[model samples]
Target: MYFNNNLKKFMKENEISLNQLANICELSINTLRELKNNPSHNTNLSSLVILAQALDCSIKDLIEDDIATINFEKVAEKNKNNRLFIRQQVFSPENVQYLRNLFLQVGVPCNISSYGRYKTASVKNEYELSSIKVDFNLRVLDLKECTILQIVDFYVSVNQLLLNEAVIKDTLIKAFETYARKLKLNQIHFIIDRDYERQDDQYSNEHSELQAYFTYTLGTESMLFVQNNYERSPFPELEEYQIEWRKTLS
Candidate 1:
C-alpha cells in the first residue's frame, strides 16, 4: 500500500481529523480533505512536501514502502501524452542572418550546432534574466504550401525578446503576414504547444504563452485538409480565430 493510505491510518490512530491535518500541514483544506477521502490520489510534489513537513516525515517515508513488490503498471497507465513541439518560419536570407547575428552578438554559451540544406541551427542559451535553460533551433523547410523562397523556421521562445512581449508579438504578426501575402499563401500550417507547466493543470504563464497550431492553404487540397483538421479539434474554440487578410500578390 502507498504511504498516503498509511498516513491516513496513522491519522486515524492519532484521532486527528482531516481539517486539523490541513491546519497543521498548511495545505488547502480541499486538498487535505481529498487526500483523506481518496488515499490513492496522486498528490503533486509541492503538496506532498508540505504534507510531509506537517507530519514530521520524510518524503521517502510517505511514498510506497513496498518498493520490491509494488506494481508499476497502474501508475504507467495513468500517464498522459506530454509532447512539446513548436514551429514558426523566418523568411529571406536577411531575416536568417539577422537572427544568427543576434545570437552571435549575445555571446551566450551554446552546444550542438549544425548546418544543412534546410539550414537547421540549434543552440543552448541560459537566459540571464530568468536563468532558465532555453534551447533554440532554426531551420528552413519546403512548406510545400508556401513559396520555396519565403519559408524559414523561427524556433525560439517569445520570452527571449529583448523588448516587451507586445512589441515582439506585433513584429512577428507583421512579418508573418507580409510573408503570407507576398507568397500568396491562403493556407498556413503551424504546430505549437499550448504552454509549459509544472503540473498538467497549471497554466503556462508568460514563460510559455503561445497562440497554438495554425494552418494556411496554398492549394485546394491543402485548404481542404486545413478545413477538416480545424473541424476535428477538441478545442473547437480555435475555429473562431481570425485569419490574417492577404492582399493580392502581384
Candidate 2:
C-alpha cells in the first residue's frame, strides 16, 4: 500500500492556503507544490516534522495509507519456473546504423554493437522489439546474486512515433512483465532522468532536475518505489535525488 501526505486535509481543516502554510513553516512554495501534486513523492523527514508541528498533529496523522495490498507469495509462485531466452550476438554495422537512425527520430541518441547480450520480444500488434538493452550492474538484494537485471535502456522507435504517453506507459509495463516472466526473475528496475533547463530568462520558471527509479513486480499494474533518497549520494553527478524499486517475480 502507498502512503501519502495528508497535507490537503490538514490545510483544509486549518483554513490556510499553501502560501500561508509555507510562510508559517518557513519553507519554499515549490516544495509544497511538489508535495501537493505528487502523492507518492517522498518528502524530507525534516519537512514532515515541521509540517506536523505547525499543524499541531503527530507525524502519523499527516500520512494516509491509500495503496492497495500486494500478494508477493502468490506472484512468486506464478513465475517460479519461467526463464527468459537470451542470446549473445554481435550487431552488424548495418544493424547498428539502422538503430541509430531510429532513435535519432525520437530525440534519443544511441550506439549499438554486438558486444552485449540482448533480449528480443514482441509488443503490441506483433511489433518486434529487438535489442532490448540490459544492465547487469546496480544489483539489489531482493533478487538472488547475479540474477537481477536492470533495463538500462529500451527503444521502440515505432511506438515513440505513433503512440501517446498513456499507451507508451502500458507498453512499457507489458514489456517489463514479459521480461520478468520469461527471465524467471522476481524483480525489474528502471531509472529515468528528467533534465532541468531554462527556456526563458526567468529562473523561477526552471524546474529542478530529478531522477525517478521504479521497480515492478511481475503481474502487477502499479510501479512502486522500493527505495528513494533525496539527499546527496555518492553519485552526485548522476542525480541529486535517487529512487529504487523492487518487484516480486512470484
Candidate 3:
C-alpha cells in the first residue's frame, strides 16, 4: 500500500506532533489527524500545501510512491567507467522508477550498473527547493548523455487574449534563460507535446483562441524553477513572456 511513513519518520526526527503541525499549517485538527492516520488517500492541493508548510517540505515528500515504467530502445553505449549525474524533480518516485528502468534497459549492452537513490549532497543553492526532501540520484549517465526525442507534451491555455502556444513557448524560454543566468545551468533542453483545441469564437473574445492544456516530462524535473525560487507557477504564461528555449539549444 502507498504509505507515507516518511511523514511520521520526519515528524519524529523533528520532534513535532500532529497538533503542532495543525497550528503551523493553520489547518483543522481533524485534517492533521487524517494525514497522520491515512496519508495514502488522494489529497487535495490545499491539503498538500498545509502539510508541506507544516513540515517545511515539498508536497511530493508528504506522498507515497506512484507506479512508473520505462522502455529501452537499445543497449547502453557507454561503459561503466564513466560517472553519471542526475537532476530531477523532488519527491518524485515515479520519475525515479522510470529512470531506473531506462538505465537498466539501456545499460544491458555496456554492462552498466546503476546506483540506488542517494541524497543530493552537492546542492549549490539551498534556496532552490530547500524544502524538498528525498531527491533521487542515479549514477548511470553523465550530464552529456543525450536521449532520442521520445515525446514532448505541451501544457497551454489561452484564458486571456494574451496567452497562446507561441507565447507560452516563449515564456518557457525566458524562464530557462533566467535560470541559466542565475544558476549557471548551461545545458538544458526540452521536447514538448501539445494538445490544443479552438473554442467557438462566440464563446470567447476573438483574441481568446484556446482553452487549457498541459505538457510535462514523463520522468524528469521541469524547468519551472530554473533560478532560486523562480517557479513556473500559474505556468504557461500566455502573455508578455515571449522567449524560445529552442533557440538557446540551437
Candidate 4:
C-alpha cells in the first residue's frame, strides 16, 4: 500500500518531525525518507507496527489506502447510538463518556455493553473472535467497585513515554501517593506490584495513566481500609518496580 498520505497524516496529526518519528520508531531518518519518497516499494509489517505504536494508533489506521475524513454528522450519529448502547448498560456518567472516547479513538462503530467490573466485554469484533485462541483476551477493572484489600497486585500497560526507571518511579509513586491519601489508606498496602508490557498492536487498551486516573476517580468513594506491611510486597514502597518490556496486545 502507498505510504505517502497515510504516513503524512499521522506525522501531521502527531505534530512530529521526520527525525522525531524515526527516533521514536527506531527507523533511521534515511529509511523514513526513502519510504516517504517511494511510498509503494517496501513497507512491511514490522515497520508498520513500530510506526503505529509510536504514533499511538492501530496498524489498520497506519496502512489505510487514504486518510478518511471524519464526518461530523456520522460521528454524531455513531456516538448517539453508542451513548444509547452505554446507557443500556446502566453505567455511571463517567463510564458512559469513557466508552464514547474508546469508540472515537478507534473510529469503529460498535453497539454492545457489559455489566460488572473485571469482566469480559459483552461485544467482540470479528477480529477478536477469530484471532486469539486464549482463554482470556480483554478485561476491565473498576477501581470504584474494587474491594479494599490489604494488598493489590495488578498489571499496567506501558506507553512510549514510560521508558526510563526514573520516570516510572516518579509516575507510579505519585499516583499511589495521591490515591492513598485520597482514599484514606496507607500507600504501602495499595498498588504494591506493577507489571507492564508495551502497548503495541492493539486497539482500545488501557494504560498506566488511565489506570491511575481510574484510581483517582475512586478517591471520594467510601470503602473499608485494610492495612498490610511492606513485607507483603516483593519490594518496599517507593522502591523501583519491575516492569516487563515486551510488545503485547495493549
In terms of TM-score, the best-performing candidate is 2
* Candidate 1: segments with Cα more than 4 A from true spot: 1-5, 68-250
| lDDT order of candidates, top first | 2, 1, 4, 3
The estimated TM-scores of all candidates read 0.26, 0.28, 0.26, 0.25
lDDT (Cα atoms) of all candidates against the true structure: 0.42, 0.42, 0.37, 0.38
RMSD of 3: 18.7
Worst 10 residues of 4 by lDDT: 213-222
Which residue pairs does candidate 4 place in steric collision? none
Stretches off by above 4 angstroms in model 3 are 1-6, 65-250
- Better model by lDDT: candidate 1 vs candidate 4: 1
- Models ranked on TM-score: 2, 1, 3, 4
Model 1 sits at a Cα RMSD from the real structure of: 19.7
Tens digits of per-residue lDDT for model 3 on 57-105? 8977766553211111001112222222123321123433443343233
Candidate 4 per-residue lDDT over residues 26-54, each given as its tens digit: 78888787666655457787878777788
Cα lDDT of model 4 overall? 0.38
Question: Deviation in angstroms for 2 in model 2?
Answer: 53
- Model 3 / residue 140 / CA error / Å: 32
